[model samples]
Target chain A: MSSIKPLVAVLCAGVLGLQGCASERSETALDQAAASFQAVKDDSNVLRSAPRDVIRAGESLARAERLSSYVGSGADVRHYAYLSQRYSEIAREHSNLVLNQERLAKLELERQRLQLALREAKLVSVQQQGKWLEAQIVSLATTQSDRGLVMTLGDVLFDTGQAELKNSASRTVLKLVQFLQLNPRRVVRIEGYTDSTGTPEDNLTLSRDRAQAVADMLVDLGVDEKRIQVEGYGDQYPIEANASERGRAQNRRVEIVFSDEKGHLGAPR
Target chain B: MALLALAGCATDPAPHEQMRLSEQALEQAKAVGATDEVAELKLAEDKLARARSNMASESYRDARLRAEQAELDARLAEARVLTLKSQEQLSLLQSRVNRLRKQLGEQQ
Candidate 1:
């Protein structure tokens, strides 16, 4: 039995030597696995963004190391080696995916911020435009009425008891034309009124002629002809008591009404 | 023992079909820009390379396994691309809602 024990020891040593040779034969796959593991561990992005995948890759690499130490270079060793490499690749991919997500979020945030700025700028522009329009209307001494805005020209606009416009009134017509040119979107209506100093038929005819003359003046000033309407109110709708000469003068006037931006002139009140 | 040997000797008749399917899946992933967009797609491409090499060496079992894995990875890449695109769409909708809210606040 003592002699047999020496024989068994020699056989055990021989088997161990064979195992060593097997491990040596598997060195290529084992080295590749080690390199992949090291590469993943060294990648700072992988460490920062893919902690879970890194841990999994490390686990697979440990398994591969254990498989490589086994008694034979076989399919199991190669399989574990492949798994280790694949897990390392997965870790890298996960890190890249995280980076992509961060970039997308940053870009989206920038877009939203830019959109907010654009909207704010548009709002400011609209408000400034509204203010400028309001200032222009005030400069024209126009009053807001049921039919948009109204500007009144007293009887001094015309020759006494005649439908013709006086030369002095040309300045007022020019100013009106400048205002209308600045706001081409607005439509205008001219209404002529007369005092109760003549026969009703004659007053009506004079009023109608005066309204048409004013409209023709606007058209001559480059305002669109279709944008102007003419009306006559003879001995009607007096704003002041016509018992005195001053009241009569106010009664015989021409009123120019401007429509809104949409050219909507509300029903005359 | 003889029956097991016979089973081992039997060849897989559909190896070519399996290889073609994996190649088609990889092509589809590439066509969708997955290789640059999704990092996992590179892994799938590597697996496909391995599968082709195994096929050339007549290692049918290894080739089949690698091919299937490659196909699975390619599909995973496709799914990831879809997920990222959906996230982008969600962000766009969120921005639109935010803009509308801002406009409403300004009107008030």
Candidate 2:
């Protein structure tokens, strides 16, 4: 009987050690869950954006605490604790998403407001430059042709054999943008022409690139891209003979053909 | 003794509903582009597989706990992916706004 008593005591000690280990694990999990809950519970943003999740965290933590007092309930306690921590994390993340979305909306509005201000400032500067420039653009550059109302951008706006429009071109491009904005229903086809100097293929590519560059600038200045059509004639439709430098310069030009106010465009050549 | 008897009688019902919920949560996370590369998604997937096995073996209590954990893990993964995407969008807009501001400054 004495031997049996010692053996039983040893068995009891082993069982108690296992229980203590399990409880220790459960205790750590419970502490972690409590910390997570404490961090998010008082956060106003989390409360506002994820109130239900925060409530669930609190409830799960409470359940875990309750289960920790029961014998052999360590698994249940840990499970609830893990769930509680996850809920806290989810709540925090949800709040962050909501705050970011709110900021995005505000930023988008600011961008629109800034865009409008910039447009107005540009128009003011163009007006300050002179009303006569507008008259010159209408009378000198624009003409009524069979294709439609055409406005020519002379070769001086670009360097020799280059597709990039010079900084000097901004004024003209801005004026074009303003015209399009004012006549919203009218679309424009920007046709590029080059002198008969380069290979026909190179001329074709350069002319297309120049037209695309102008179209890109118009888009950057807030013109709707759908209203712009680009075509490259590649020495096919020269305004003057390409034999002399002066004549070649005249031939290397971009012409803007405007659609009628009803948005009717001439067929592509 | 009575408490032990009550506990024995209170065998947990099979967590079919919880398993379904966890599966739905996992699908939702995946739908939002949460791949196995996401640690939370991997953890959720592992736990959910174990939970399925537990369910098949009629270990309802274990299955319920695992499914519950998996559901939250998947939800957290989804929330993390969404938050990350929003952060990316925020930076993109910030750069665009800065560019606009610079252009406006240049114009002025």
Candidate 3:
């Protein structure tokens, strides 16, 4: 009886040792896996920058661990069968992920190409279409150049201190809309500027309000909201300095920048 | 004689058993090549596996050394993973700083 008691104790101790070792090893393995995942999350900048291999390996390891959940027991036919199925499934999953990554990369490249083309076209149009405005509005740089629109706020638009579009200013706005509508493909950007006569804070506020008003007016005239973005620089960045009357007159102006596609970026609401 | 032979073969487990367990643990080394440390551990595990199986069938007393080597390799791999994780965290901090800078510039 005493011999049997010792044997039982030894067996129990052996089993416990095995369990401890397995658990410790598993703990270390899990910690490593977690660290790897954390690295991928931190490093991946874009949608597909994370390592695909880590994701695939982690999935397979999880599946394998699930299969061996009933460890130390006798061989389980069902467990083995499940494991085999899981292996095949993991293979398919890995391939699918690779395919998805490739597809996404191709799409991004295509988008970049289109964006480059759009930018080039904008540069050309900016150079060619708005040139006439410099001569017609105020002869700042080119009295007769074929590039870029130049709208003088002092001359044809609102009064020196007002944000309201004047009666004739309405005609100019209408003409601008007509130009956009006729082009039907140019996205317009409205930039508002002001003279240094007011406080910087006040100028900033006024410039923003003026830009918003112009944008709002465009929207009312059937321009898509998505295609338009408004930025107002009060007196910080003036094409012409604020030292002279003529320069201030030149400064108080609005410039329209169009998007590559003239239609609304989002649903026209 | 048969009983004695069976006892010799089946009695107390060999050090090779410990090595086998370690080898099995190595199977956790995922089959990935991601620059991540888990992959490095797995790769190291495969190398350690070569040493392990050799020790398993080895006639000498080197199995003990082989098992220890595998453990060391696993530890190294885990360390690599930790380093990668720390690097990743640093990169995230950099990104946050960039975002804050951009916001400040826009405000101005």
Best by TM-score: 2
TM-score rank order: 2, 1, 3
Tens-digit lDDT track for model 1 on A127-172?
Answer: 5555565576567556764566788888888988788887887887
Deviation of model 2 at A77, angstroms = 1.2
lDDT of each: 0.72, 0.87, 0.52
- Per residue, candidate 2 scores C-alpha lDDT tens digits across A1-269 of 46654554455346666544466677789999999999999899999999999999999999889877665666677888999999999999999999999999999998888888888777666444445444645774655677877888899999988999999999889888877776678899998999999899999989999999999999999999999999998888777888999999999999888897799989878
Model 2's TM-score against the true structure: 0.60
The residue-level lDDT of candidate 2 at A47 comes to 95
TM-score of chain B for predicted candidate 2: 0.91
What TM-score does model 3 score on chain A? Answer: 0.40
Q: After superposition, which runs of candidate 1 have C-alpha atoms over 4 Å from their true positions?
A: A1-56, A71-79, A125-269, B1-28, B34-58, B64-108
Tell me the docking grade of candidate 3: incorrect
The parts of candidate 2 lying over 4 Å away from their true place are A1-20, A127-269, B1-10
| Residue-wise C-alpha lDDT for candidate 3, range A123-202, written one tens digit per residue | 44643445453233334322213323334444347677677766766766766665565456666557688889989988
Best-to-worst order by lDDT is: 2, 1, 3
- Cα deviation at A33, candidate 1, in Å, is 3.8
